[model samples]
Target chain A: MAETVKLLFSATRETVYMVAVSVLIASIFGIPLGVLLYSTDRGRILENSPLNKALGTIVNIFRSIPFVILLIMLIPFTRWLVGKSIGTTAAIVPLSVAAIPFMGRLTETALREVDRGVIEAAQAMGASPFQVITKVLIPEALPSIAAGITITAINLVGYSAMAGVIGGGGLGDLAVRYGYQRFMLDIMLYTVAILVVMVQLIQVLGDLVVKYLSKHR
Target chain B: MIRIRNLTKVYTSASGTVKALDGINLDIEKGDIFGIIGLSGAGKSTLLRCINLLEKPTSGSIEIDGVEMTGLSPKELKEMRKKIGMIFQHFNLLSSRTVWGNVAFPLEIAGFDRKTINEKVENLLNLVGLSDKARSFPSQLSGGQKQRVGIARALACDPKVLLCDEATSALDPETTLSILKLLKDINEKLGITMVVVTHEMNVIKQICNKVAVIEKSRVVEQGTTFEIFSRPKTQTARNFLKSMFICEIPEELKAKIKALNGNLAEGRVVKIGFFGEITAKPILSEVVKKFGVNANILYGNIDNIQGTPFGTLVVQFEGKNGTADRALSYLQDIGLDVEVVEIG
Candidate 1:
């Protein structure tokens, strides 16, 4: 029982690190890509139809691929980039790649929900496209975008656990190594409890942050 | 001054072709409050959008202040758009911006210095009677207040022409009156030509000196407000006037008037419309004394159109058969429009 508890603690830390790092990378690339998708449509102030469609198609294609298959397929590339594809650090490459498309789609949806009239008002005022996007669109969409980020963060937590199946050092790996292989039901139970706790903590924090950021609140 | 020649816009949707504006030709003289009245789908809004090239016309030319807008490049179009202000029915102020920020937007886009922008924004907010709402967001404002901000922002560049696309349609009656008065004041004070598009005759009556009635993507009637109201030429103009003024005359009221008056052969009921200085003259008394016809007043309405009094009187004439005809001739001779109505 004591050994089970120790394994659960280490696995919980690994899962937290992987989820946090991957979400950070996803946000960096995904938000800008999403903004680009929004501004580059036909009739938009900075319209470039081909570019917008191409980026949108690429994001969609990546999002449609199963995350488990993506992790396996990215193993060779992950090894080349990180010099290893087994640990939590190497696992981050696939995790963040999977998250980018997911986060981008969420960000795009959030941004699209912003009122077009607001953008027009900005343009009618003689604001450049950049100013409209930054000062008007982004600010108006911030609350929805923040909620989207929370959704992405929670999704990444689930993806990170799946990453453990490929020998990635997280709670799922700990469950397989010390619980499944050895038939230690107590270890599996403890690992499951810790993961539940982690997920619940993230969800509560996300809900609170989203509520705080919302105008109605 | 704004001039549009053969301005056309065609939208080819999946279903087929829709001609939003078909060869619209208009010349708005300087300092005239021109009103374009039309029903929904009448292309009035489309005409206003074409002025600023918001909805780029498929063909034709738009010249504002003698500069052909259609010929300008994109950069030039943007620059020219700064000098042609437009407001919308929805009061499309940026929700993310405060009242002050919304007013300052155009100035910032014009690349004014921070201090000058601040001073101008303050003055504009004060002008709109929203001086205390500088820091308040659009969500915090009422419909009237939001539209006032729209007005202030549109005036930010101090354009020579202001295009209003049903600018007061969203406000209550009292607020609409105040906004109309404000626009009239602005027109007089700044001498800015305003092109107001609305379906409401009241709006046209309140501020427009010149008006054009559009129907089915075409200008069916165009002239001074007095000319259109006093003598509507087209069927479209007559229909609009009937709906605007006589909508309150219920079917029961018409039936009662018919029952009380009997058949048309007994007497002649004429509708007389008077405008300007002619309204003050006791024309009814003069007609009775001059033509020896007994004139019984039935229904009457007098309204001020752009500070000029326009009056309409429905009266029944009783006496000799030829006396009614002579009375009508005398009324017309005295410069009052007299249209004889057939009683059923």
Candidate 2:
């Protein structure tokens, strides 16, 4: 029973590390790409149809691939990039790759909700397109975008657990090695409880953050 | 002054084509409060948008202070737009911005320094009687207050002309009047040319010195408010005036009168339109005394148009057979419009 608790704690820590690192990397890249995707469309400020369509299609294709398949497919690239593919650190490459497309879509949805009339008001004030994006669009969409980020982080947490299937040292890997294969019911029960607690914590944190950020409420 | 020549705008929809503005030509003098009035889908909005190039005309030339706007380069067009301010029906202030920030937006776009922007925004907020609301977002303000913010923001750049597109339609009548008064005050204080588009004749009557009535994408009547209301030329104008005056005997009323008044003759009914000073001098009494015609007022409406009184009266005349014709001629000679109506 003690052994099961120790393994569950270690798996929980590793899962947290993977989710944090991947979500950070995803946000770094995804937000700008999402803004580009939103602004560079027909009738928008940038209005480059071909560029917008090409980038949008690429993001959609990446998102359409199931995360499990994506993790396996990214193993060789992960190893080549990170010098190993067996630890939680190595799993971050696939996790961030999956998270970027997810976050990008969320960000696009957030930005799309900003009133077009607000954009026109900015333009009527003689604001350049760049100023409109930086000053008006981003500020207006901040709350929704923050909520979107929270949703992305929660999704990354779930994906990080799936990473344990490929020998990434997280809760899922511990459950498989000791609980499933060795038939240790005590380990399985402990890991499942910890996983539920972690998901609950994340959901509560996300709800608080969203509530704090929302201006409408 | 602003001049729009040969202005045309065509919108293509999935179903068919709509000519929103067709060959519109207009000249608005500087410092004039001009009103463009029409029903919904009457192209009044389309015409107003063309002034600021918000809705680009298919083919036309717009000249503000003798500078052509139609063919300017993109950079120049941006600069040109800064000289023409506009307010909308929805008070399209940014929900995310405070009143101060909204008012300062144009100055910021103009790249004014922070100190100058702050001072200008403060002044504008005070000008709109919203200094206390400088930090409040638009959602916290009432409709009239939101529109005041919109007006202040549009004025931030100190544009030479202000285009108002149904700016008061969303407000309650009392609020609408206050906003219209504010617009009039702005015009008087700044000496800025103002063009307002509205469907309400009362709006035009309140502030507009000159008005153009648009119908089916054409200007059916364009004149001073006095001329348009007093001598409406087109059938559409007459119909619009009927509603405004509310004294034009309807077909139902005429039928009822024929059935109710058995003594009424075929040519005894007439409608009279009186304008300005003529409405004050007991013109009906003058006609009655001079022609020995007995006047029975069936309907009457008197309204003020831009501080000038205009009136309409529908009456039945009974007298010696020839007296009715003499009374009609006498009214006409005194500058009243006398339209004879059939009676039983």
Candidate 3:
């Protein structure tokens, strides 16, 4: 029982680390990618159809790939990146790669929801394209973008669990090794309970932030 | 001051090509509340946008204060745009920003320091009468209040010219008047040139010193507000001022006219327009007495336009010996516009 407690504690820490670091990395790359996708589309500030289409196709290909297959497919790149093919740290690569496109698509949608008139108002005031994005577009879309980030974070939590399939250590790895392989139903139930609690906490916290950021109320 | 010479804008879509503006020419003096009045789809908005190069004109030249707009580089255009502020029909205030932040947005774009931005925003908010609502978001304001915020934001850069794109179309009648009053006050206090584009004739009537009537992507008429109101040359201008003219012959009057069967010996219906000192002089009565014609007044109303009293009267002239024709000619001779409505 003591050993089980220690394993659960370590597993929870690994899952938190995987999800947090992966989300952080995904956001850094994904936000600019999203802004590029939005601004390069036809009729936008930085309109360039060819670049927008190319970026769109790349994001779509990544987004359409199944997470399980993506994990295996990214093994070589992951090994090259982190000097290891399997572990919580290495799993972040595949998780972040999959989430980047997802996050980008969502962030684009959030930005697209901003009013066109507001954007024109900014332009009329002599705002450069970069200034428009940073000052007007992003700030106006902040609440929706925050909501998108929340959804992306929740998706990362799920993806982090799947990272366990490749010897990536987390609660899912603990559950599979002890509950599935050793037939310990009680341990599996404990991991499921913890996952549900983690997801709930994330959702509640995200809603609070969204509510606070939303000035439309 | 703005001078637009043969400015044209052509729009092409997958469906076909459209000429949004064709050979528009205008000369607006400084401190003038110039109005572009047109019906929907007449391209007045496109013309207003052309001033700031928001929609680049397809051909011709636009010069503001002697600087050619069409030839300006992107950076120079941006600098030029900073001196020209615009307000939208939708009152496009940033939803996420407080009134203070919204007003400060233009100052921020102009790269003013934080202290200057604060002081400028405060002065602008006071100018627009939104000082108490500085901390409130746009969603918390009414349509009129939102437009006040829009005005405040537009004035933040101390722009020399202000463009109003149907700025009061979204507000109620009372609110529209209030906003117009504010615009007039701003124009008076700051001596800023203003270009207003609107379909509402009342908008032109209320504040415009100079008005250009646009029809079918072309400038049909351009003159002082009183000139256009007192003597509308084009059919479009006449149609727009129809409500102001009260030329609708009463049903009873129409029946009375129909009873005469186009007999020259009986009477004729004439619509006479009087402007400025003409309204004060009893010219219609004098014409009747001089021509030996009996005049029956059908409809008449005096309107004060730009401090000038302009009135229109529809009357039935009963006389023998071709005196009605002489009376009509005499009215036309004395600078009165006379149109034969019905010959009875």
Residue B156 CA error for candidate 3 (Å)? 1.3
Docking class of 1: acceptable
Q: Cα deviation in Å at residue B140, candidate 3?
A: 0.9
DockQ score, prediction 2:
0.58
Candidates in order have lDDT scores of 0.84, 0.85, 0.90
List the lowest-lDDT window of 10 residues for candidate 2 chain A.
A208-217
Q: Write one digit per residue (lDDT tens) for candidate 1, span A56-119.
A: 8998888889989999999999999999988889889999998887778787788888777667
Arrange candidates, best DockQ first: 3, 2, 1
List clashing residue pairs in candidate 1: none
lDDT (10s digit) by residue, model 2, range B1-344: 89999899998879998899998999999999999989899999989988877778899899999998788776787887788888999988877677888888888888899999999899888878899998888888999999999999999989999999899999999999999999999999989899999988878888999999999998988999888887788887777776667756777878866764576563377788877888889888888998888898987788888778887788888778788888888888888878876666
Best by DockQ, which number? 3
Q: Which pairs, if any, clash in model 3? A: none
Off by over 4 Å in 3: A1-4, B250-253, B256-265, B284-295, B317-333
Which DockQ-derived CAPRI band holds candidate 2?
Answer: medium
User: After superposing the true interface residues, what Cα RMSD does each candidate give?
Assistant: 2.6, 1.9, 1.1
Instruction: Give the per-residue lDDT of model 3 (tens digit) for B1-344.
Output: 89999999999999999999999999999999999999999999999999998898999999999999999998998899999999999998888889899999999999999999999999999999889999999999999999999999998898999999999998999999999999999999999999999999889999999999999999999999999998789999988888556856667867766675365465678888788997889887798789999888877888888889988888888888788888889999989879888533
Query: What TM-score would candidate 2 get against the native?
Result: 0.94
Residue B325 C-alpha lDDT in model 1: 86
